[model samples]
Target: MKKTINWKFTLILLTVGFMTAVQYNSMKNPKERDTRDIWAVRHELAVEKQLHSELLSEIRELDKTIFTYKSLNDENTGKALTETVDKLYSQAGMTNIQGTGIIIKVKPSAESEAFGIPVTDVSPDLLTRFVNEINRFKGLILEIDGKRFTTLSSIRDINGITTVNGLNVSTPPVSMKIISPSFKDSEKLYSYLAASTIHDDFYIDNLILEVGKPERFVEIHGSPEMFENQFLKELPKGE
Candidate 1:
């Protein structure tokens, strides 16, 4: 009985050893071979991530390049943008269409103040001098008392109505529209006119002045070639 039990125990130990050896061999050289596959998959994924990052970076650079190209192509991009916005404003009926410039409406003071002063306070010579002064600053005169500079003067003898320089301009209080490049120039001209000796003895009461561009006028086309070199330098490569 003792020999039989020892042999049984020895067989059990040998079976356990053989099972352990099989498991070790299987781990060492697996049939499915998933060990190297896991490492390879991880490496591939890492490479793919790196490649994706690189592609994304390159795409960002491409977007910048496209922006630069567009900016270079449009020399008047800022003006174009402004026009677009203005057009939108017009479409919305929020834009006021009027001539832009300084409107100097100089009228004679009340008759109660001075008796000798004539109703037509602003003389033609004084008007001419004012116009000349405005011209010195490159200001373009648009209208004088509802009469454009291009039109001819009219006279009405029957009703004692007379017009000078195509405008039914009154002597004391004259209304004129002068367009200058800037409000500063307009204000300067206005100050000079107001302080001049020509208007010293006159009873000037109402003086209305405003500055802005006219909505409707003959469009003046500027030369693009005037800034050709600047445009060229601003142009994109190969454009």
Candidate 2:
């Protein structure tokens, strides 16, 4: 009888231990899944950004051809030419956007300063992920440190400096202006960004991301140099 009782107790202990392990694994698997998903999204966005840049370049070329032909020969050219130019400028991020929007600022974290850890350049990887996430959340006309974020805009690291649209944003207190479609949209984006783990990501890099309240007249400056297809001028007419 004693032997049987001891065997039953041992079996119960093994069962409980196995159940605990299974529960722990089940809880941990979702975190792994989330990490994989984030990375997969980042990879997809990188590929898509490249494809988008190529496609937009081609589209701009076609538009230039159409514009040249229509402007040179069309009888009712005023309206059509104006519309075409506007569309081209908008797509090229050359037209200033003024409307309701949100501002995001990145600066050195207080904790890092308190801990005597010197602030470092913002990680390109983290910035890319943050930008992609903002785009997904309906952020339009995004300007980072006064540089317009376009399809052709490149954000990368050069000698430990974070370059955005050929401008260095390696320093702290980098400001990002996001012009949304409307006040409601801007508010929604602000809220979404406020609750995002993006802040945590920046914190890991010794920075803090601040999402400001949505406000009116948030202007995003544009660049005339955004579309530099001047070679289109050399193309022969009617070809």
Candidate 3:
């Protein structure tokens, strides 16, 4: 009878051990699966964030490039660039414009009475004296009739053969344009020239005067300090 009891007890103990082992294994499987699922979600989120950061960086770079290109293509920007270039050119002593100013045109007097001499036959010295007088008033010559003047402007003989500088350009029935900074100075100059003996036989007329506008061509070269300040202050940081 004792042997029979011992056998029954052993069987019961074995059954309890087997059931505990199975239950523990089942719970562990589910916990392990949950851990793996969490890991996968975190990994996917990391990848998505990395991709988003890369896309954002690319977008920022593209914006900068587009802005730069559009600024260069704009007309106002072009004008500014041209003006900057002109300033540099002036500093280099390669420009023709001396200063900001206006252009004034003067026409010769028309005569109804014939002086028995053709207008073209008039002495070239008269024209030379007139040009000299205007220059004395600090006038910069632009044109005489169709002739264009430059930094090295000069007068030539009516025969169009000889060149003269610092003298009245010898020509008949002269038409000329002058560039000056002051309208008052230009008017005074006209008054002086008209009252002088040079225009005694000719009528003096003011044709047109053109003033400089605020808009001008400019070109900026090299990285300026202002750009450095702007760049440093506006630089983007990483995500």
Candidate 2: list runs displaced more than 4 Å: 1-73, 224-226, 234-239
Assess each prediction's global lDDT (C-alpha) against the native.
0.52, 0.84, 0.49
Instruction: Give lDDT tens digits, candidate 3, residues 1-239.
Output: 99999999999999999999999999877755444687899988887886797689869966875576577855677676576667545433244443322333333333422344333322345445555656555434344454444444556663444344433443343444454556566556556654665545334321112222211221222211111234445347773
2 or 3, greater by lDDT: 2
> Once superposed on the true structure, which residue ranges of model 3 sit more than 4 Å away at CA?
1-116, 121-123, 158-174, 201-239
Question: What lDDT tens digits, residue by residue, belong to model 1 across residues 1-239?
Answer: 99999999999999999999999999998888555777899988887886797689869966875575577546777665676567544433243333335566666554533554435344455555555455545435455565544212223322343444433466535566665455565567567666665454333422222323332332222111211234444557788
* Pairs of residues at least 3 apart in sequence or in different chains that clash in candidate 1: 99-214, 100-212, 100-213, 100-214, 107-173, 120-171, 120-172, 121-171, 121-172, 153-166
Best TM-score goes to which candidate?
Answer: 2
Per-prediction CA RMSD (Å): 31.0, 14.4, 33.4
Q: Could you give candidate 2's per-residue lDDT for residues 1-239 as a string of tens digits?
A: 99999999999999999999999999877655444687889988987997798789889988886767666755767666687789878877888889999888899999988999987877789889988888775337888888888877999888778898777884887888998888899888988998988888888898999899999989988865745575566658778
Candidate 1 matches the true fold with a TM-score of 0.34
Where's the lowest-lDDT run of ten residues in candidate 2? 226-235
Clashes of each: 10, 0, 13
